[model samples]
Target: MILRRKENLSKVEQKHEKLKTSNMKWTTILLFLCFMGITMASAQQKTFKGTWLYEQGEKNGTIQLDLYQKSVENEFDMDGALCFGTFAFSDGSYYSIEEVEVEGNKASLQQVLDTEMGNFKMQMTYNSADQSIELSTNGANGLPDKLLLRKSDIQNQETSAESPIINEVDNETSSPINWTSIIGAVILIIAMAGYSLFIINKKNEFDQVYTTEYFSATRRSNGKSPQSSSEEDTQVTGLLDKLQHELTTFQNHTSGASYLVVLKKKQHKKCAGYLRQAIEIASTNPEILHDLQQYAHILANSQKRLFDGSYSVMIAAGIATLLVGYLMSDLLIVILFAGAIAVYYLASFAPQYLILNKVANSSHTSTGFLGTLANIVGNAKVITYIFDTQDTIDTITGDNIYRYDDYSQVQASVFIVILAYLVTGIGIMYIACWRFFRNFIMH
Candidate 1:
């Protein structure tokens, strides 16, 4: 009986030992699994930093995406942290950035930018191995639907090796864009355009307005006494009124057009014929007849001069020359524009001066008042001299009016205003080209 009992005890001890061994094995496995879980969690955290290029049609751009760990928690999950990124067009005109999310070898980012077209929402995914990104978005007009981007580093590396000196210069001189200059240039351009249109409209208004002397002459030419509104004013007055009405009608119809022809030479010739008949009927004395004839001749000439398309051609040529000059790298375009403006401003006086001077010289009275005035006005050199003298007088006398007469003031003022306009236009363009495209120009 004692032997049987001892054997049972030994059997029980073996069973206990077996149970202990099983518990130890389970503990080791659990510890191993826990260690593996912690390692995997640490390994899951990642950071990516690089520049990426994207192209879709004409809309190609660069994006700099950099993801940095914020904390242990964020280290494990990049989406919980901040990722800095910037997107810029090829021209470097507009740029924007926003926080992004990263996981494994891919990162998903979302950003919104306010542009001239409208608001744009950008969604992108990046692959670290290829240094590429896929930009995807829903159908948004003016915004890319899908874009593929490769790293710019490779391209930049090739460029840097080829043009180290140019790159160095760019780095030293070309900093970030000058926002002030850009804004100023745009504002100046708008202001210049508005002012130029205003000037042109003012000139048109002047051309349409008849002087008091002209109305008096018209009334005198007609045989009938000047009557109230109901009575027919005069043939000249009626024709002018008709012309004015037609102009208003044309203006109303083609308000945005550059030029409108309301009265043709045929209409003006009819007016002249009516005026001549009226003058013949009203001719009572030799002096009155002579005055009436002179008035008729002036009316005919004025009608012929009303719509001088030469000025338009000159202006168009000047502007075209300026644009072509800029493209061709010639300063002659600037000179051409300046000269054209000068000619346009002095156009009214020039033809009169030339004709009057020629008549006076032929009549052998070239030294008389009319001859002297014509010579002074017609000769470009004499005009330049007068302008210079007036400028000198202005500088020396300050506020006190001295050598400059009404005629001189008119001429000088016109020239100076045109010059100022040209200078201002050039200055605006210079600021735009220099500030915005400095790198392109310098390199």
Candidate 2:
């Protein structure tokens, strides 16, 4: 009897193990199905790519969906395609759709106004059967729930036919960006930049060395008076005589500087140049040497004002161009600025550095043609500079201010200019760039 009872107990234990194994197998199958369901739902191809219009109890507007823009986001992360949208109500109220979360056919749309997440939530369900979307909203007064929006009839018929071109257009789907073109363009730009630099270096090679040796601060520190040679004295005196002749001959058409301003600057650079040569090789009187040095210093300081002003203008244009380019995301727009600004700016450097650097000024050899024409496209600063008559600071000391007195003034100007241009030139592009960067940095 004991042997029989032990055998029976072992059999029962084996039966219980089999039952547990069967349950485990079924649980595994169920979990696999659930996972697959979620995957399929999320991975399903979806596009709400047409203008959707709804008229439900006087809540009517068009929701334009750009098929080209795909926004994917994971909260507080910055790694998803931007979801682009706009909401225009019949009451002339327009709101931008800033956030989108989609799971299968359902999507939640969100927006923020004045730094606050709006109190309204719009949920949409895409109905494939009707090519329509059912929208539900909560937390907003007088908003309709279960609002149905049909695709525009043309879009509907096109969708029904399912032509690839029509579908792409109707959905506003854009192809992937061709990075190859952009890379090639950038490489070309770099090569051009290098070539420009090389050309400038080759053209002005000796001029640089000559100017630097004479005007360098080290020359100031040396303080060793250059003793005269008879030849140098004769040469410098001849130059001085010619300069005096030019200044005094005020009436004849002898072909010197045209404008009064040009006359003054040419006179200044010539005077400065003459004094420098004279001091290097003229009489050895210390008092005479000191006075020449002082006057030379004054002329040098004054002549530089024109170059300084032009340089300042160039710098401001550069900053504005960069800021505008950096803030814009559209490849076409960025390219436009890069090309125009590059041509406008780079076109001038050859003239400025190699040609007119010895006497850089606005009304002189450096300022008229190459850059100003190209830069006239969009730069406001360039516009002002082209028309600007003031070329010097008079003096940089004793209560003189350059540009604006405070940085806040600069900030305001930048902000205003950016706003104006964005509004006038790039309403849609601005929205697209803003959305792309917003998700990228703050997702």
Candidate 3:
């Protein structure tokens, strides 16, 4: 009886141990899932990509925080990580974070900070959507206070490029026009001319109505001799002639007109409106209606092509500037040149799209080509200046202020050289386009 009781007690103890192990396994799985969920949530938010500042109420005065991401490049593991930069801290202390972990919208930062008092282990939490940050210490020889930070969008400090020393390099030597770009530009112009000629030839030869074939088929179907249909055919031919003459006049007025002729604020829109009005008064003949449609299409296409070609030259000029600067080892010039090109393209394309929208509806809008170009050039200058001098800050408020010398004459000369490059490209392309359209008009 004693042996039997001892065996039963040992069996119960083994069973309890097995149950505890099973429970622990499940708990581990659940914890892992929770951790993965948090990681996924943080990724979805992309919580660290801008500037944050300490609020006015915080003891730290005029502290700025900027966070950005850098990618870790490894053959096996490719991922981006968050990095933080602390600027203008009150205590003149700075942090160099070693690790960052994100949980949902909040991110935790671990950093070793050296302050006036002493070195401390600091912890930070960032809330992305709220654009706020909370800071504390680990309670072991750390910061004595907690603080909050908010995003400062308006008075944001821009990082500026280091000023380049302007030595006595000749303008031509500093920014030599790349012969490769010139060759490329020449080839592009030739291609544009070839394509335009082909299109114009195709347009000239296109017989949308097949009037002769239709007339012949009609004669065969009716089995009518020349005498029988002569009277009716004469009247019909006269009417067709009159309609054809009218359409020719309309085409000449619209697509065949010169740039000087259509220098209005809404050139395409006005032309399209006139075409629509002509459509309403057009002949009922199927052939005449088809011709009208073809002419209208030609006008729209010609205008669109001219604008597209001009804008493309502007972009090409920008590309040329970039290439030349790169080859010359002028990094600052390259950046400014790239910025100007970007601004120029955006200014050209954006308004043109709006104008197209207006033209499509045969409505008028207030936009002109020269005016648009002027605005683009002006805006590009301002943007390029900001980009070149990012670290230099100037504001109406007295709190945060930094100043640098105004744009000098050398910069202006550099810009002129850039502009000249653009204009040369435009001139080449414009000549090609003009010749193509002249031939089209003659046809």
Candidate 4:
């Protein structure tokens, strides 16, 4: 018995270890992505990249230099940018920008002239800030190897600058997803997710046993009785098969699947009840009656709570689902996380959502979903809608003071309340993950 318990403990430990790895890996990646975003947002293009009109031989020609293709989003170490831009002639002909390099305040641009475009001017179809516009031709030749666009050129020329760059397909992967420093957002998101986890732990702070004793229906839901002896025999045999299957699976479940066994045990009890009812009025052989009684007796007295389910897994998963779904700017990461969640639930066994929710949400039995539901809604409002808001707080507080030409004056600022909510939510997450295996994983 001790050896068996040791094996069970080992399996449980292994399971927990995997969960730990998954949680840590996910959190780390998200933090990294958030930091990358911040670095990129902060390293943003200097005040020098834009259109420059140069007068060469009395011809007024303008050049546009876009630096978005080569992003310094990685570590702000980017010096060379392979950007695409254009210079239009009065006749609607244009030069496509090949590469651009920024030094101090001067941006040096290069364009490999493609004569085959036949004066195909880039119109609404070219959006460099959103997508890279690459010009292609059988043979390329024309514009000078170097054209400089100075930052102080708007004095005599019209200039449109500060356009976001595009995805460049080259030696490196076109779309680079590094980290986040758009950090305020990422930290806020992580903090909110953490708090959700903490609150889930708080709300689910109870244990309750579940059983099929409440089932009122014993006969099959078809509402039709077996018309003949053979039909009755078939029904009896089927029920016996189902009961045996459920019982066998219940008994054979691993230590890791003890919670799933709870589900299976409930199923066995339900099967036993139905099997007994089926044999009640039927012309049952003595062997059948004896078999039904035995199984029912066994199921009636099965031991429980020998093991436990990780109560916070579902809550963690729910928080993870939201975190990955909304926090991750990368679509692939979101899809991967979402797919894992879907596949796990598709099995309909481990981490069973229904059972998990019953355990996690025992706090709201009296108040109904409204209790838990309102709590979750309030948390969301606090995390998202409450902070840095312009007017919702005022509307809620009834602070519509009539003054100063507009209601914004009355609305004023609600940032303090939002900041407090943000800090509280994040703090909860931090506390939930604190050591001693306290909140989320100890079970």
Candidate 5:
């Protein structure tokens, strides 16, 4: 009996040891999994950095160049044209080009560069093995354009034969720095400016026509008034008497509508800032909260209108600047103007349009005298709310908003049309510069 008890205890000890071993194995596996997940996330965070060649169309023609981050969250340079801020890969599906601009899974390296063209939208694919970036546009007939750069071409120099070398041995070594290329670039700039100017002129014409047509159509819909004042006055007096009677009837029967209109007029009067503070205080004491709400709404709306109009004007100025830049081939000028135009329109024009639409469509919900007063006062509130609800307040406040202006939009359209002419001008300038530099200056 003693031997059997000892044997049973030994078996129990063995079972506990076995369980402990199993637990350890599982713990090891869980740790390994955690490590792998962390490593993967870190690797993904690595920026794609290097100098890249931007080739479009034939290789012999003008080509753009760019410098990108070796990994994620770094700065990049665009062929002496533009330098972008830091970028990052937020998830496996998308990345941010700069801290602000985000792109989805369909986003690739080449698409980023194509944004500079300001004309065509493109996509990109990266090749890790060859260290190359390829681009393609969307839609039918989309052919991939391959741009290759070896890791050695852009990576940090190592103290080994495989590392990229920058030789300063030949101080005078130069590649004739193509005068034709410089000339071409200059001409292109000029042409763009000229085209922009043309667009502005065209936009003015279109706006004039549109405004005239709108007013004419409206006037025609309303019958003309009689020329004789004496005859008209007699008819008008009778109509006025009838109107007075009807208004009295409306005040009694349709108090809601009449109250609403009166409330609206009062709100407008308050917006004009003619209301005495003492009167406002008395009204407030009487618990005329509806009147106060209406006043506030009107004031807010008026402020918005003022801001929108000012912004529209600013956008117009920016468009004008863009036109000037296109004509002058001054990149700095163009960028400044374009930027201003974008900011004004985004801030004022776009929000106003949205607000106007909302106000026109939205229905009043408030009832009774106070409700009707609130409804009347809240007309502007509805519009302002719509503006606030937009997905991009910055975009609404940014330079892109100026693009919505009739004049600006028209000008931009015209600029595009006149771009061909500008291009021609640039070509001529290029040829002249090429001849002067190659034939005369070189000799």
Candidate 6:
């Protein structure tokens, strides 16, 4: 009987140990599952992306926030795309959108939104408890309109729907064959070539006409005008005529077939300089001066027209190259080449635009300065001296300001170009590596 009791006690002890082990295993698994659940819940609690409408006093506006999912480690998805930022939630409110100032837990949003009545600012307050939002307007006073919005309301409704028609439409529209763009590119190339050729031929024709009309003219018929007295006058007129002929030839030669349009710019500048000199030399003679000014005006106008045309053509070409690159993505080399070309053109144009803007600002400042000086300076000698001194000082100061602004703009442009190059170069290199790896594995 003692041996049997001891055996029963041992058996009970073994059973209890087995039960304890099983309980521990289950407890560990349960804890692991709970941890996983908490992580998933945290991820899901992130902010949703959509249009947030808000109101200010007597005005309504809509703030559209496009959120991207975070792609890199240490980054969280703001909307669908990953971004390197953490979500901020405080005082019963959450802030997730970009470009809005958030203080504590409150966000201030001002935007112009289209409404049925026209455009208005729609002010909204978000409450996390009931997933409810309230909208009010300063226009509508303190009486706020309440809206109950669930998480589903901000979801991408289209993504949930299974509609073949919609999918087909999107596929067709988003990246269609772009035959129109192709045709336009071809037409543009042809038109540019034709225009350049026409300009060359027209300039040649004008030169011939001008030479024959001016050089072959019989000395002013006896009674009509006084004879040119100074030998210098005759010599100057002859030089002017020769210079014009040379300019016409230069324009025709340089502008006709060059891929680099800047050559044409240099020619235009030369023409302007010659015209200015001719006007200065012939200033005293009415008829001669009139003719010279008219000729100068013609040259100026032609230069402007050509400059504008060239700018348009270059822009079109850049766009065409980008489009072709996009369409012919299979040819990676060609795509890269096109991208480089587009970037080059962009860089060139950016500088030219900056120069033009600078010139315009300078002109405006000069005009304002002159106007102010004229208003302040009377006929008095002392006033005149003061005006001249001040004007000179202002000119120097204005030039310094312009130089600083230009330098800043140039620095900004350089930074932007560097950033673009880095991004594009990395992307291209990654694609190349990926392709190489894929090909090697396939083989």
- Give Cα-based local distance difference scores for all models: 0.40, 0.43, 0.42, 0.39, 0.33, 0.35
Q: Model 4 Cα displacement at 314 (Å)?
A: 21
How good is model 6 by TM-score? 0.23
**Candidates ranked by lDDT:** 2, 3, 1, 4, 6, 5
The digit string of per-residue lDDT tens for model 3 on 1-443 reads 45346546755975776575456444433443443354354335544434456644344544333222222111112242222444345655444333444444444554433333244445557765676767665653434556676766754353221112221112222112222233333443344333343333333111234344443443344444312244544444454344334332222235674221222224444554555444323233455545555555544443432223355455555666655565557655454445444333322322222334345455444444344545455554322222344443545443344434555554665576567655644333333334333322211
Kindly list the per-residue Cα lDDT of model 6 for residues 1-443, writing each as its tens digit: 45446546856985776575456434433443443454354334433234344444544433233222211111133345322121222222222222222222133333322212223344445566754445344452222354323333343322223221112221112112222333333333333233233332332111212222232121222221233345635655664564465443212233474211122344545655665455323323445545554555444444231121123323334454454445434344344444433323322222222233334345243333223333333221321111223233345455322111224444554555444433444343223223222211111
Q: Which candidate number would show the highest TM-score if scored against the true structure?
A: 3
Candidate 6 local distance difference test against the native? 0.35
How many angstroms is residue 355 displaced in model 4 relative to the true structure, after the best TM-score fit?
Answer: 21
Model 2 scores a TM of: 0.24
With candidate 2 superimposed using the best TM-score fit, by how many Å does residue 174's alpha carbon deviate from the native?
6.9
lDDT of 1 by residue, 1-443 (tens): 45446546855975776575456434433443443354345334333445577776676776555433211111222264322444567654343333344445555444433234244455656666675767775544454577787877543221112211111111111111222223333443343333323323322112232334444444444433432233332443554444434331122223564322323334444555555454323323343334444444444343332112234334444555575455545453355345434433323232222232244346353454233444544653322222333334455556333333345655865565455444434433332222222211111
Best by lDDT: 2
Q: Candidate 4 or 5, higher lDDT?
A: 4
Q: Number of clashing pairs, model 2? A: 5
Question: For residues 1-443, what per-residue lDDT tens digits would candidate 5 score against the true structure?
Answer: 45346546755975776575456434433443443454354335323334344334453111122122212222234342222212122121111232111131222423333223222344545566575545454531233344333333544321122110121112111111222223333443343333223222222111111122332333233333212234433443343233223221113233454322112333333433332231112221122323434433433343232122233234345445545555555564455345434323332322222333334455642243234333444442211112233244466555322222234444554555345333432233232223222211221
TM-score of every prediction relative to native: 0.24, 0.24, 0.33, 0.26, 0.21, 0.23
| Candidate 1 deviant stretches above 4 angstroms | 1-49, 55-60, 67-83, 93-122, 126-131, 139-141, 152-443
Q: Between prediction 2 and prediction 3, which has the larger lDDT?
A: 2
Report model 1's TM-score to 2 decimal places.
0.24
Per-residue lDDT tens digits for candidate 4, residues 72-170, read 221111453334555565555555545544333333344344335343222211223432222223232343333322232353132233322123423
Q: Estimate candidate 5's alpha-carbon lDDT, on a 0 to 1 scale.
A: 0.33
- In angstroms, how far off is 163's CA in candidate 4? 9.8
For candidate 1, the per-residue lDDT at 324 reads 48
**Residue 172 Cα positional deviation in candidate 2, in Å, after optimal superposition:** 17
The collision pairs in model 1 are none
